[model samples]
Target: MVLDIIFLMLISSTSHVSANSTTVLPAAAAACSNGECQLRDECSTDRDCAAGLYCLSCPLEFRGSRCVRSTISDPFKLLNNSLPFNKYAFLTTHNSFAIRGEPSHTGVPRFTPANQEDTVTQQLNHGVRALMLDTYEFKDGIWLCHSFKGKCHDFTAFEPAMDTLKEIKAFMSANPSEILTLILEDHVEAPYELSRLFRSSGLDKYWFPVSKMPRDGQDWPLVKDMVANNQRLIVFTSDRSKQETERIAYQWNFMVETQCECFLFSCCFHLWIGL
Candidate 1:
């Protein structure tokens, strides 16, 4: 079963990598109509908006999109980082690698649908704590893809899995207080390849061992403890057998998931509903 949501993280600290990172909220920007627009203020470009917002347009909603909140509340930072890992909610991006305007491979324009408009690094900077990635064994290696008929053709492939994992590694290094979860829709048939991929990406240093995961319904380790130990990366694979063979956490054994299929707001959406 290919899961639609993969990783979750406790976003507690800011990264120095974001060029637009700022905490200042100018008082005059609220009234200005030309530039430096605040929330609910009119804007024409992303630069015209404040730090955490961007100019957006919706054909059905009025005429244009106003500055809206893009960052999620950090429970760890708001209260404390000592709480159990599962005690806080996280923001997740579905099919994060199916990015819009991604350059085509195989010298052919991609016909597959795109699921995201920003890069993985941008999503992380914007407080997206989780990412859903579809991994398949293609072209002799694991690649991020939008699987069709359970196969990853050249047209559907996004990029090598290592690229995104390296991005995560860089983000983790820049923000030491954060904890991330990666949920993999495992289609890779190669034995132990997943383990190698993480190691090669330099993410192995932060791997959260499966032995530490709770089998029964129980609280996870404190966010502070995970950061201190540097076991900040939690990975889950859909393939059940990997739990034993590759030492990767089998997602279903730990949590219950229901993928939301509806795209419209009026349509019913499924929830995680807990373990």
Candidate 2:
């Protein structure tokens, strides 16, 4: 499979906190060290936990970081896989491509980031299923920038969107059963060129065709269907011209209008599609 190739091409390059990995408490619970946690009995920080557990502060139902699981449970995993992709809710990030005030782990250097310190890969790994990205044509590349200027910031700088996207591709390659949605605020003069990035990153293989997508008010295909066929990646853009190509899906046509109003340039949503 094409993903198999991508997996190999990027496997050695991808960097993420493995799911099975654990960490220490936020602050010092008591300055506990490996000696105290060696038996998997005590943990001062995430690193103090054993190989399988992470540190979490919980109530009486669950105590200590490594001793027990979190009292909370992830509801999304309990959803029926047979439901259409749109029927389920997803987590999304605003300024998905921008970092808070530091450079991203997988993007170009920048003095100032959009709003978050975490990179796209970090967000995705943390369970954000959708992203709100601003796309603009910079000096030679299509980069992610903040503001209507669509150019590098006065003090901060724009990051090459492709870099973030390639990492996204890497994440998708590794997590096949998951689905991702990209909502792009278009500021680029030309949108068709985005396809080049898709091809270059090898994400085109995972592209969910707009033709196959459901219209507003229409139900979407099941998550199993999308994952089974490897159509787990979906893209939507504010620029309608981009829709001329197979890679970009015009957002309004697919996601119905909602009471949650947004300006033309803003792309982030609390939860945009499905119930």
> lDDT values of the candidates?
0.73, 0.60
Each model's TM-score? 0.82, 0.65
- lDDT tens digits by residue: candidate 2, 1-275: 00000000001111222222234444324545553443335466767655444454434223554433212222247776787665565556667666655444335555553555466777777667777778777767777777555555534445677888888989998987877878888877764577777788788889889888764345677778888999988888888877876448887656532334444333323323321
- Candidate 1, which ten residues in sequence have the lowest lDDT sum? 13-22
Best by TM-score: 1
Global lDDT of model 1: 0.73
Best by lDDT: 1
Tell me the tens digit of each residue's lDDT in model 1 across 35-78: 57787665677777777776765443334556655665776688
RMSD of 2: 11.2
Distance from true location, Cα of 10 in model 1, Å = 11
- Model 1 TM-score, 2 decimals: 0.82
Candidate 2, residue 235: CA error in Å?
0.2
